[model samples]
Target chain A: MTGFDFPPPVMPPGVEALRAEVRAFLAQSQAEEGWRPDSDFGSDWSASFSRALGARGWIGMTWPAAYGGHERSALERYVVIEELLAAGAPVYAHWVADRQSGPLLLRFGSEAQRRAILPRIAAGGCYFAIGMSEPDSGSDLASVRTRAVRSGDGWRIDGTKVWTSNAHRSHYMIALCRTGPAGESRHEGLSQFLIDLEGDGVEVNPIVNLAGKHDFNECVFDGVTIPADRLIGREGDGWRQVTGELALERSGPERILSTFHLLAALVEAAGPAPEPRLAEAIGRLVAEFYALRAMSLAVAGRLEAGALPDVEAAIVKDMGTRFEAEVAETLRRAVPLEPVAGDRDGAGGNAPSLASALGASVLGLPSFTLRGGTNEILRSIIARGLGVR
Target chain B: MSDETLRLIEQTADDLFAAESGAARAALAKGEWPEGAWQAFAATGLAQAALPEDAGGAGLAAGLAVLRAAGRHAAPLPVAETMMATLLCHAAGMEAPPGPLALSTTAAGEDGDGSTVRRVPWARFASAVAVVGPEGTLTLRTPADVVEGANLAGEPRDDMALSGPPAAAGTLPPDTDGTLLMALARAAQLRGAMEQALAMTVRYASEREQFGRPLARFQAIQHHLAEIAGEAAASGAAVDAAAEARTPFAFAAAKARASQAAGTIARLAHQVHGAIGYTAEHDLHHWTKRLWAWRDECGNEAHWWRVLGTDAGQGGGAALWPMLVAAGTAGTDAAAAAGEGARP
Candidate 1:
């Protein structure tokens, strides 16, 4: 009824303190370790970088204490993630685990699975790769042919998952597989299994991205055995589980901050006195950025109150991703200087900031729109929410 | 005006328009003026919503509220134009048009026959056309419909063939006020069209698919669609800021932003709709066509930008920041003023 009058995103009383702690930790880490912040590494996967964050009890901050979590609010976790992303800290190592896997296990995983996996996630020692997209199953996730036949005490998984980000480095993966025959509903007969990447019969083959980096992999799960308890939630509920996971995945600061580093770089390159056009563009961008941040916080607030905020989340993601892409473009057109030796190579090499960010951003941009759900899907949700449809 | 009064005005207009115009369908089909609809709106005190309270109208700042409802339903009646005319008349200390009158305006021009006025569009549908002459005098005339060309909305244009006893005309100084008001009205129409286009595309995307997943699942599609959302939101904010400013410059910026956004959005909507969007059978074209016409109607993007650019240049380069701050802070009330100093 008013200006974003929803519940405040659930956060502990000390969440601001937690943010201050993370900021101090990052500042110290940058000073001591002399880490070179790379825009190309949108999310860092450095083992050392992750363990340092874990040491401060920042990783898996929202899970129960018994599972090595600090048992904080989701908003507190959101604050930490926002700070980490803004600082461009290398956080890819435990990102998936902290973001969704740890929470997923706590919710639907068996006791043995939670006990075995979550503590490592909180300690930042474990990593997880999503095994949803296959070679032929890019957007058509329901058509995945990856199958797991029931064995004596476990299931034998034999299929290849393509575009599996960080599969080579991840300790384990939660793969969606067909455990039953194809039925009337394509969404039916699907189940998710937590497979150990280091286990026997599992192969992690590198798939080089367009940037010539091994950020993704083609994992072959040939006769990979997972114990009966490895299945997440009830059988045939994979669709519902994945949908819930997306609500978490899509409704975060990540959606808007993808091009944040580029913005910083552009500002730095522009110097204190910007050209009139450039200044105006930056000012407009900043206004939209603030509005989006408020919108995202509102969604986070909704989710913290045990509400889905599905349509609102979609709106945030939609607006956020566009702003990200636009920032990259705006910087490309505004700045005239090239990166001096150490900067990453982007497309065309003319505008490296745009190129480097755009290279990852363009490839990654598709997923931003399509990943959690397409913009079109989100709009439909918004339309329904507004009662216009 | 208070929120309750605004709500009441919106509800009354929405109800009367729905009943008299039958949700814009009858107007869209017959191209006949909804005289009854106009009378109902006048009865509800919306015909002069922006006039002074002493005038025979509600005298409330109901611009945004009225625009939102009109945009939602794509109502074709000239509510915004009528309100603008009423405001201008009140500002000039002239008696406002009364009893279901459609008011139109045009820029000043020279004509030996005392007929041609510069830059007048949609002059045929007006009961009376107002023209600002070369001497800066505003002249009102009731003219024949031959001068107004065919309008996209199917309504008769308001172009007037002027030939009458020269009536005394009011004068407005060289400022952006009149142009700004016209631009705001057009921007409101564009805003409505943008919302409709977004809704149409989203529906199409959900029901249609190419590679198993809904077309909405493709990242490329989502990215384009997301851009549309961003544009719409930005334009909405800009329009609101302009309306709240009640100044020529702010409204000029809003008009420029809204016009550009509407054009881009319309093109993208058609792109997302693909071949189906181009067809007449689909109602998507109705909104898209209106967007194209509206963007170029009151003032095109190029014209407004040139005006804004000239104004900024003339005001000196340093004035840009303060102007921007003023524009951003235009819409906030007193309670929201704490952070006002922190804006730019």
Candidate 2:
């Protein structure tokens, strides 16, 4: 069988120094800002923290310097993002932008769009929300019903985007709207637009999650007008562009490290000398973590080498997300503590105690495998890659 | 050796192993040494691949790559055991002996010269056995009263009674970890075997029809194949990481992950193949059975899991991430090589 080539990752020079710098910055920021450590990126967002990180050139990494990027290696970007996630840093403000949107823009956005928006993203002053999913479209993203009609000199967007994370907070959304008919394939005749979230006839209603938090929103677009130049790529190339960025969105350390905080807390609770069974569980999880990280890093290395390893990226997400949920369950069964939702305030009052971290993780576990793409869809992608479909 | 040369050697090894597949199956069935296959492998001088560069051998990475290809075919021989034995022999300044080599990790008990060592892989076929321990390395040319044993795959794993002075004796290198190396070898083999199984299962699903359609068309079956593919990919990545890093932590992680994947991959592969996969006539057993045997040979998931857990525990919670990063990136290049293709 011809296996996917995931060559071992090579760390760039000065990576360790960069890692140290990020760590020192994070430690100091956490101390000074007094922000509570969240379970994952979605649990927290701070504009100041994102701006501070961007000022250090962590965001917009691996992009061309002409587009306000630091021109760092993908591996360097990997290390910085990995550190942020592992420390439970408040990175949601710039997460989508740094991960996929900026790269998408650099690759497909118009010149004026790049010059005007990319620098603001690099400075972490601008945030982006994805507008691919709808009330009818979840896994079958090609079945999106959102339509963009040609009106005046611009386009009028008239559809609703559901489960849009932070649409209320994000400045712009690259919405995949139907610009033409589905001739032979549904993936055809689709286009992406850089719709301003604050434009006329735009409404973002919060959808409280299971944990009683408002990270997601249902955005309604009623004839929202956008400039003609706001199109991300070619009019009919939206499907290709969106699929192109899946490798970037699916293969990062975020998929697996969502429960990292819980693991660290479990280790702390287990103490220096845990029981044999407890140690075994923890060790098994840790080993899986290491292997999954290696796989993700390998994919990042491949992407850095200019190969779009979609199948490999899907495998990473499939295994990594399962590992994430397994971590939560393993902790719940192995640790002898009841999960309790701690105080709502920041770390100044009550830090994320072990119970609270576990609580947050349990509540957030369902979305781990469901978000980005469902585990079923990911497995289907892998199966297709294996030529089974 | 340069990567180009290593790739060529790997290709040659893959072809040789593919050609020897029949001999491997026959040898296992008859419980005899695959003399033709062994001779063919020896002619390639792959045993010396893991030796020091000054010793006219390629580096560890090349050696692991060769072993990985060998494991890919499930060649019924002691390729890993022999390669590692030769490494120890050369490091100890002993001229490497001919024929297949068996490896043992158990130290000589209170009886010393007359001690009994168990679970020696391919002991009956071995021309010489290398017994490595904390004390040093010892080579036994002959053993008295060999009790024949076989793993699930029907490869020899005999018990031997040693009753004489060693043919060669020398101190091991400071970094020589016999168990870790053996585990790494098995991990590589597991990676190869899983890939083969995945390929076989994928092919079977695509070709075999059920209810007037290929089994692969069914979402349930496709998902099974997908899980197998996922595990195989993870196992390969883990093996590659460990081979590049060569650290205790890396090896432990690799073996544990591979061993863990071994169970799921074997189960899913068998499930997807249906009854045909379980029968002895089908070649799928050649890979699946070995996956079972290899997972427990050097160290299983549970064994290595404890090693990693204790490591993390001793380091405390704060040190987990750093330790993982160190193990994952150990021995990697300082940067991507210059002149590589850039992303568009």
Candidate 3:
């Protein structure tokens, strides 16, 4: 069979102008506010930084004007995100809300929910955390044990969510909970609840990562009251909604850009000309990265057209994560020492610039293939798409 | 080469292939040349699809339509090898073989003889063999004793013992082109096998349920399938680009990419399939086994990687950017040419 045509990722006409505007804005922000890039190992939630970005209409650029968005195409947003991530901007505050939750709510939430949350998300005043993974239901989301029982005109939720990234800092968490007993199909009987983290009955405890960072949390809900209207989409449709949301979460520049900092460090360390092995490794890595980026963009194009590129998205994530892992490995091999103190501040230290970053990346790499949906899961989907199985 | 021509060729092959039924598979099982199936393909001029118009061939260009039929059906004949042989002949200004010829090659140092042409592992099934000697001379040799055999698909890989002067000799340029062609062909076959294996695993996952849900619903299975799919896609694109490649460096890159993808995809397929896939009773073995053989048969991953690595070194430290630019242009040109060739 012939190979599908995958054109290289280039800015659409006028995209260069958009890039210039963003770069100017970022440059000014960097100079005026002393904006240091976010730490590679920690979960960052900088409200002021996100607010500045949102004020510039960069948070939800692809959404409609009514929702405080600029009505840009996904490709434009892609370029914007790439620049943001490449610059290591402190975007974690609005990352989930803008990257996925806002889009999800826009698509599946009730009109009231959208009207209430969309603007705040666009304004970057609000943040969201995914409460899908429970202690027992990280990958098998359908096995979520969180329960939400009807209480008068609202629901009382009681369960614990593990690995809730930035839950302590998020304004709201969209939790996938069982509204009823497990149905014949595991995916049935599940519903999503939008819980306010500041509410009285919710407790967010730190789940320190391997880097000893409080980026993730174990969020316990003890009879947390939520209005019935807070449910996303129809009750018992959590699986479909979550699956759609994952299409947003898993297929993006983030999967590949996790190693962008390391790449930059490598370029700096190697100078104009690198060692033979390092050069070859970097070359292969860059080629694969380019290919993976193309695939991700292709999926984005398909997603924008309202198509369910489930298999295609899976393929992108699998390849993207593998490439990131490879980059991490290559960097580790090329430079063996640790990044000395003040390396981030450019003190001309002998420390390995990527040492701390590599530590975090290595710990995080396993989850790249395991989290969202494991690599194996995506492969099966691809296999089915090919009609071999 | 027009779209209409490509469509016509594919349609014709599809029809003839449909009519031929299980003859190829049967021949494969019997370790004999699928002569009947070959005749059916010859009648449709598939053997000469890539040959020039003057060579009594269909003059189809190198592309998907020409390769798809062979891949989809797992045709038991050496259609690709023979096409490469025909191209070599044409390039050497020699007449292409008329009918029922099998083309094969031996690695530079692998054969038993120090100077004489030696038998390759898969050379047994050919009626005639094209041997390219170390001096860059190409020879068409007919062996004395022919023994029927099969490769991964049970397709015939007849054995022939060669012991005579090389016939119909012509010289190929002492460059990487011949080796590149071999690598490309092997990569193409690996791509085909990967596609089939992926299809098999996915279908199995959907239909095969455990714990009351389809295997596909499991995250582990999905991840496995995704890896396989990604690798297969990468391999397909790489090999297709390699086939149309002009430069040795471009060929090296494509070969490296394809070989890595093939090995990874095959292993993932087997892992997803589990016990049944490991057994000879299941058809999954057919694809996986072939993948293993094909990956190592031509220049293996290490060999090609070194070639690419050495090439990069020679071009200096900043060689990567230029090499990538060159590869991209070459890939685009080949794609455009293939597209043009498929036009009516």
DockQ of each: 0.05, 0.66, 0.13
Runs in model 1 lying further than 4 Å from the true structure: A1-41, A47-80, A115-125, A199-201, A267-326, A336-389, B1-16, B20-39, B42-66, B76-189, B197-258, B268-286, B293-344
lDDT for model 3 comes to: 0.67
Candidates in descending lDDT order? 2, 3, 1
User: What are the per-residue Cα lDDT tens digits for candidate 1 across B189-294?
Assistant: 6776677777777677777879787777665666566656656665665565544444455566666677777778988888889998898787787677777777
For candidate 3, the docking band is incorrect
Q: Pick the candidate with the highest lDDT.
A: 2
What is the total number of backbone clashes in candidate 2?
0
Ranking by DockQ: 2, 3, 1
Fraction of reference contacts reproduced per prediction? 0.01, 0.68, 0.11
Query: Which is the winner by DockQ between candidate 1 and candidate 3?
Result: 3
- Interface RMSD for all numbered candidates: 8.2, 1.1, 5.3
Could you tell me how far off, in angstroms, the CA of residue B7 lies in candidate 1 after the best superposition?
9.3
What is the per-residue lDDT of model 2 for residues B1-344, given as tens digits with 9 covering 90 to 100? 67798898788878989899677769777876788888899999987787657667776667777787887898888898898777767655576678888888632131234377787888788888887755555565564577998899888888888767877777655555666777777788898898899899989999999899999999999899888888888888887887676677887888899999999999999999999999989999999999998888787898888877877877777787887787776544321110011010
lDDT for residue B50 in candidate 1, whole number 0-100? 54
Tens digit per residue, CA lDDT, model 3, A1-389: 31232323433567757766876786687667665543231234679989998898888889888878889888788767766765566788899999889999999988888889999999989999988888998667888898988899988898999989889888899899999777787888888888888874689899876655677799998888888788889988888998888888877777766766665555455555555566667656654654465566666666666777776777777777778788778778777865433335454322323555666577667766776677766666565565534
Error of 2 at A80 (Å): 0.5
Model 1 gets an lDDT of 0.65
Tell me the tens digit of each residue's lDDT in model 2 across A130-235. Answer: 9999999999999888999889999888999999999989998889989898778788989999978876557999999989889899999887888799888899
| Candidate 1 chain A, poorest ten consecutive residues by summed lDDT | A1-10
- Report the C-alpha lDDT of model 1 over A46-87, residue by residue, as the tens digit: 888888878888888878889889877767777788777776
